[model samples]
Target: MTVLSDTSIKKAVLSGELSILPFHDDALQPASYDMRLYWKILISPMRHENGRTVDLRKEPNHTFFVEPGRFVGILTEEKISLPLSMVGRFGLRSEFTRHGLVAFGGIQIDPGFKGRLAISLFHAGPELIPLKLGRKMFTVEFNQLADQASKGYDGPFQNQSTFHKMQKDFILNAHTTSLAEINTLPSEIASIQHRLTMHETFYHPKREFPSISELAKAQGVSPINDITELSGLLSEEDDIDTFLETVQKWRRGNNNDE
Candidate 1:
């Protein structure tokens, strides 16, 4: 795919072919844009292959719970209208990833892909970041299509307005007997916790729990009321590498579950 240049991206933005406002990047390169995180994350139940209902918006604004190593999808403030010939993908910045954060999602827009673009976002980190609504999440880079295909994403997810949890219902109806035998639930929970933490550390670094005690007060971690006790628990763990790896795995798994 041919990558769009900074100049072309600006042109597209100005012409209304691509929709995003308050564009703030020094270079304005198409390889990446500086995106901000949206505060409101919408979670939904996974769907079945036969198109049966698993969830019916039972909880509004209560999307997926992003923990470490989970891949949850969310939308963006910017709405896109790609040309019938151009397609692209969204990628998370490395600077954010180093902090144990990862983001992904952008479908292959065919030659006839139309309407506003929806991003499939996932976080694989160690901390939970309560993303606000209407926040910029990531920069999108456009790529040229190889002779424009015919098929586009006009399926169930088309014209999706908010964060679409397209996989929730399926999980709810999965085979309980088989899932229990394989020990799935525990692993899934752990993954969500891991990624959510990474997202917190990377996207919302300043807000991470100051110490174990502070973390405990929150639901996931232990509840250590005293600062001294929290400090002691942190000090006891010396292997930084092990800790990071464990968190990362958890976040990735969380996304897969969604």
Candidate 2:
């Protein structure tokens, strides 16, 4: 089996023997094509727990932070199609390895395989590693088979293009268990309800507000309750400071009249 060179790969792509959707000519390397990270990822959860799927595109900067010793499964941005005479394999880009990230998937691509590649990444560095969307993270190399296989690969993960949770039932159960625990704490719920009730009672707008006549009676002054008077005073002022001074003078006159 001979590994395909850049020229051969280009020829195969043009001849319809291979297809790379959303291809970029600049991403083609000497003997391989660079593959970019997709927006979706599967985060490996804690021990005895179920993993969760996250879409990095929905995150800030379209990025995800993976702590040291954490593992994540990511998908490739490009969709690939291989004919019966060709197989593909992928490896981590040198830049990622330099940052102490280990990529462990795409060891083999069977003949006639077609789909986006799923990459398993582990952060082996002492510091957290940030994986960004649309970054070139892996290199895919194609190989020509000696002969076409008798049968093509049609396994369960054959056309897996999106991130999927492996233990979906466990995630559902964990969510249900959390709700059950919260429901059993009636005292805590009651305490929260009481606090909310007290806050509502204290801050009721209608109860806290006093009418202009009531305020004037309390201060022993005549109420300047006419809207037309206030509007005329405001219209006569050229600036905010003048308007404020006029209002203050009006208040002082009311206090003097009392």
Candidate 3:
């Protein structure tokens, strides 16, 4: 498979061959853009005899809380009709990962697979990164397959329109269970840990807590709400840390105390 070049990315967007998400304030670069999660998601209430139990279409008003500094998988509303002769898969934008966010699934593309995309996102940072609805999180980069493979992902998730959590079998495995015993596990696990810790040190710094009343007034919202509620379920220590840093930066009071 050949990766899509920057020019190809632009051409695809212009030709409607690829869907371009809403541009966020932080999404200008020479290469790729970002995408955001929808407000609601469908969660399975219980496991039934077969995997065909819960359907997202059946539930309309279902809500899933997307806490700041966390991850969620969402389905894009747009659909792609790939010609049978061509095949492609999505690639995660590296900038998002640098910002302590995840945008990759299994990184697999099936031949003859035609449908919308399901994006998986995870934030390993401490600070709350606010995301607005319809904002871009990552751009889709397509690769051309030399020859279309026999198997494609056409069964369950095709033409999916809503965000739903993956099945239980998807996450739990030898990787999740016994780590030390696996021969190849130590280096891979260590590498992931190293990257995560490094990201926390650099990008996910603590933030200062804004005064709830002040924040409410500034945002032109209600003041009676809990400060935490207004803060979107993010860790409070991050805010406090930011506040402390800002205070230290401007500790020299010129005329206020006089």
Instruction: Output the number of the lDDT-best candidate.
Output: 2
Which one is best on TM-score? 2
Give candidate 3 misplaced runs (Cα > 4 Å).
6-71, 149-152, 164-258
lDDT of 1 by residue, 1-258 (tens): 788888778777788776555466553654655555443343322322222221213323532234443344444555555675677666555554655555544435444444444544344455654444434455567876677657655666566554445443432233222212235778878999999999988987785336766656665765558777756554565777766777787877843332
Question: What's the TM for model 1?
Answer: 0.46
lDDT of each: 0.53, 0.76, 0.50
**How many Å off is the CA of 118 in candidate 3?**
2.0
Query: What does candidate 3's lDDT look like per residue over 156-208, in tens digits?
Result: 76655543345333322102221123455778799999999999978986667
Models 1 onward score TM values of 0.46, 0.61, 0.42
Q: Between 1 and 2, whose lDDT is larger?
A: 2
Question: Can you give the lDDT of residue 153 in candidate 3?
Answer: 58
Looking at candidate 1, what is the lDDT of residue 2? 84
**Model 3 residue 95 CA deviation in Å:** 4.1
lDDT of 2 by residue, 90-123 (tens): 8889988998788764488888788888767767
Question: After superposition, which runs of candidate 2 have C-alpha atoms over 4 Å from their true positions?
Answer: 46-51, 164-258
lDDT minimum window of 10 residues, candidate 3: 171-180
